[model samples]
Target: MNSGISGYVIQRLLGTIPILIGVGIVTFVLVRVLPGDPAVFYVTGPVVTQEAVQAVREALGLDQPLYLQLFHYFGQILTGDLGRSLTTGQAVTVSLMQRLPASLELSIVAMTLAIALSIPLGIIAATRLGTWSDYAIRFAATVGVSLPASVLGILLILVFYYYVGFAPDPIGRLDPFVATPQSITGFLLIDSLLAGNLEAFRSAAAQVALPALTVALVVMGPILRITRSSMVDVLTSDYIRTCRAAGFNWWTTYVRYGLRNALLPVLTTVGLIIAYLIGANVVVEKLFAWPGVGAYSIDALLASDYAPVQGYMLLMTALFVVINTMVDVLSALVDPRVRAQ
Candidate 1:
């Protein structure tokens, strides 16, 4: 059984190679087809010399043939080089790494909040069935799923920041007044705590609260629905009936047997939601002026900077693949029948 699971993991990982390569190719092609000259975007002036533009293009390797450029790009990718940003002249990897922690911090917190809330609420909704609690949960889930993330973010900012005057400025990760802690992990909240600065931690938390809540509320609906459905099914399963028939109480029967079985689908849903939040939080990031890869990609796309845009796509694609693969492995681990199959 262990050997089978090992083989499954190996097979799944090997399968991602082609997917990454395909994504890289498509990203490269699409970014190049974007309508703008990176050199023009880079050179700042009311009037620019043709020689200067030509020099910028040459320096950026834009003068190369399409096939040669693609070949060189693939070679650089193999060597772990994402190339320099055409606009910023910084290494694409460096720029991405700098911002990725912010995205990771937000997504992780949001996902954690969603899962933490969704599971118990789902269990309640399932157990209650036709009660007011169930109806309320369903209604809230429906509303959550129906709302657009951008609109939700705006509402939160307005209500909390503008009207209530409680939310920290929907700005970056930390307040300007707060002293930034030593960058151990690049996560302001964690770094501040590591530095024993409770004030900085509070400021960081306040800054992330609205954006994180926005992401969590938007993502919680699917997880809640999946959890409720899975739990409802598990509650009616034969083993659960057997546990009840064998004199197990309602709580024990549901908690021990039902929830364990129900968690597989919930886990899958949570994993997919995590991937979505991590990759697709551009609107929230932009709205909050959060320094994340999503906002970075938007800037790069607007400037028609091919390298950064391509790099973002490839990085997100690889992240999606990694996350899905981990989910698959975890699902197999949770349900031995999956690995057995």
Candidate 2:
């Protein structure tokens, strides 16, 4: 994938359009089919009259024909105007933006932790080959992959927060008593640092530790497996063998040749992991009470709040397209086989 990033990215972007549109259409249709209409839900309980229901439906524009509603929804998408939340009356755009930063911050930390730990473990497993250490690493990865994310999060909370009393409460992003740092990038850590508030940064970082560790454990398994497999294959390749035969410096040979060549598949896995973190961290988010987009989407989905769910899905789809395109470009740059194609 180490060829030309720009050209590959452009090609991928072009290919991604149809896929995004298809996803948007599917989400729009699927959300509408789910039980519990916003209008119906809001108009429930005693004295539930047809007029009241009709008024609520009219207010939410649910009375419009399906085609006309979809056409308008697509227009909103084109104009970057996600509709207002039917339940909360807040603009979907505003809510998503406000909550998005927290999700991004959590995901970035989780993946960073995963990559840091998983890569070395993977490298060790590959280098150790048939040793007991390698078998132990494989076993750990299998267990990690097997545990559901929520259970992993609960375990972390029990061990660190409840038993050890080291981790912060799983109430939300910050402790109940800690004053919030001034918002800069909306990332609490970076913003606190920028504001020269070490205390704030530390407070925010502590709150995320348990949840981030949970996500890291879940993500590390696949990444570890892939990295080890890639490194194993690369180490056995002719160039690597030549380098070893030539008696090149050990670390240099490993980093410059072995690691670089193995990054293509790793990069692909990383991109998918990041996207998964973005959209599929709902269970973890719930366990930790993290104020993330996934939690917001879950709340909306429960009430059949169409706009937020649709907007959330659309945003995730666009994100996958953009992030994966970048990954494809990187892969093309790293592997000449990809570049040649």
Candidate 3:
């Protein structure tokens, strides 16, 4: 069984090769096709000599054929080089690394909170289908799904910061007044605790809470709805009915016979939500002034910073591929038919 699982993982990973290549091709071409040149965007002022622009273009390898440029890009990726930022002169890899931790930290907290809240709520709602309790949960999910993130963010801030006065200021990760933590890992929340600095950790957590909660609320909708649907479907299954008939409590029958089968769709939704949240939190990041890759991508897009934009896209593609592959493996482990396939 272990060997079969290993073979399944290997086979699934191998299948991602062509998919990633296709992603690379699309990302490379679409970014370059955007209107405006990097050289023009790099100029600080409206005024610039034609020769200076041409020089910038040449230096950026913008004059080369698109195919050749793409070929060189693929080669650079092979060598672990994402190229340099047109604006900051920092390596794209370096910039991404610096910002990724905050994004990861936020994404994880939001996903954890969302999944923790959503799954049980969904299960309870499913069990109580047609009651006011279920109606209330569905109504909340509808409101959550419909509310714009910006509006939710403002409401949260007003309630938590203005009225309650418990949440921290909605500035960045750490307040400028507080001393930043030493970075063994880039996550300040963890690093501060590890360095025996609870004060810093408290400050950081407070500041990030509202934004993370806002994102959590948004992500929870789909997860809740899907879990409810999957649960409802599984509750009506033959095995669950048999278990229920054998003098088992509803909870026991659901747990033993229903939930395992229901989890595939729930897991799929969770994986897709994680991938989407990785990039789709630009508004949340901007609202909180959090320096995350979503905000970085926005900056690069506005500036027409070609290398950074392409690098961001490629990284996102790689992330989605990795996430989906893991989800597939988990799905196979749960469903024997998938392993046979």
TM-score of each: 0.95, 0.94, 0.91
Can you write out model 3's per-residue Cα lDDT over 1-341, one digit (the tens) per residue? 47877777688678777876787788788888889877986655667988888888898898899999989998998898998887788999999999989888899899999999998899888888999999999999999999999999999989999999988888889978888989979998999998998889989888888999999998899999998999999888888778867889866877656778888989999999898888888999999999999999899888888778878877787787778878878888898877778
Q: Give each model's whole-structure lDDT.
A: 0.89, 0.88, 0.87
Give the runs in model 2 whose Cα sits over 4 Å from its true position. 1-4, 44-46
**Minimal lDDT window, size 10, model 1:** 1-10
State the lDDT at 309 in candidate 1.
86
TM-score of 3: 0.91
Q: What lDDT tens digits, residue by residue, belong to model 2 across residues 53-156?
A: 99999887789998889998999989889999977889999999999999999999999999999998988899889999999999999999999997888888
Error of 2 at 261 (Å): 1.5
Model 2 sits at a Cα RMSD from the real structure of 2.1
lDDT of 1 by residue, 180-231 (tens): 8999999998899899999999999999999999999988999989989999
For model 1, state the Cα shift of residue 137 in Å. 1.2
Best by TM-score: 1
